[model samples]
Target: MTGRITFWFDFASTYSYLSVMRIGGLAAARGISVSWKPFLLGPVFAAQGWNTSPFNLFPAKGRYMWRDLERICAARGLSFCRPDSFPQNGLLAARLALAAAEEDRIAAFTQAVFQAQFGQGADIADERVLQGCLRVSGLAPGLVQRALDPAIKSALRAQTDEAIAMGIFGAPSFTSGAELFWGDDRLEQALDHAAAVTI
Candidate 1:
């Protein structure tokens, strides 16, 4: 049976990076159509009285998370680097993603940004880095100008608002109907739930 899933992610989330890289192939194998929804975690965290990532807020947690990420990346044969900044500003990237999603280039753009940030330890907030990502993704560089459009900015805000309305509080969340699954570990479970449902 065919199924549908909405993937909600934040550009700066480490675990989200893992899901972004693998979800596409895994979902395709299960006849599940995936929707890439990029949203900001700033507002969500603020709402919960967090000024930063829980990993950053709690040193013990932060240490554990980095080690966990290292293990996960090694096992998956993916590059891993701890960014100088824990959560880089993703405003520009989110706007660009919305534009890329429209042109059916979300996968390429998303992976490029993730790789740039996590794989190369580059700052994603830099316009030049983003431009490079656009180039590597086979998307026209002019899309960067489009990302500056007011409407695109508004669309990103709307997406974040929608995510909040859907009760999302974290990244790499999967929604199958009203069921919500959080984290990379839950990806397959979410897909299975989607597949089992007759939507």
Candidate 2:
């Protein structure tokens, strides 16, 4: 039986960067279909009475998160530049990715966006930056404009609303039925659980 893995990722999330880089091969080996569902965690946090990443809400943990990211990226041979802007606006990027999926190029788009944000320190909110990402995926810039259309915006809004309803409060959340898993650390377990449940 094939299992569906709903991946709730936030582009600004560091841990999510690691998962995106790693999950593909892991899921393939397990014969799982990884559904990439990108969404913003900020709006969810706002509703939860929090203003920022918990790492940011706490000074020491925030500091440690930075240093830890540097070490992890180094170990994985990945770039670790913390963008001057924390939690770069990812709403538009996510919308564009969903738009790319409609064109059958979501994998390329996802890789490019992840590399642009986590690897190259590119500004995700900038139209030029997004266009560059789309170009890297061999996609036309026009689709991004389409993603901003009323129809797509409504879809994106609905996705966010559904995520909130699913008890998702953070990026890197995963779900199999009503089984909710939050955080990048839980990604593998979620995948395994979904696969096992399907079996």
Worst 10 residues of 1 by lDDT: 153-162
Task: Identify the leading candidate in terms of lDDT.
Answer: 1
Candidate 2: residue 8 Cα off by (Å): 0.3
Instruction: Indicate which candidate wins on TM-score.
Output: 1
Residue-level lDDT tens digits of model 2 in 40-123: 788888997888887778889889988987888899898767777777888888899889978888767877887888788888
Model 1 scores a TM of 0.97
Name model 2 segments beyond 4 Å from true: none
Scored against the true structure, residue 103 in model 1 reaches a CA lDDT of 94
Clashes of 1: 0
Give the TM-score of each candidate.
0.97, 0.93
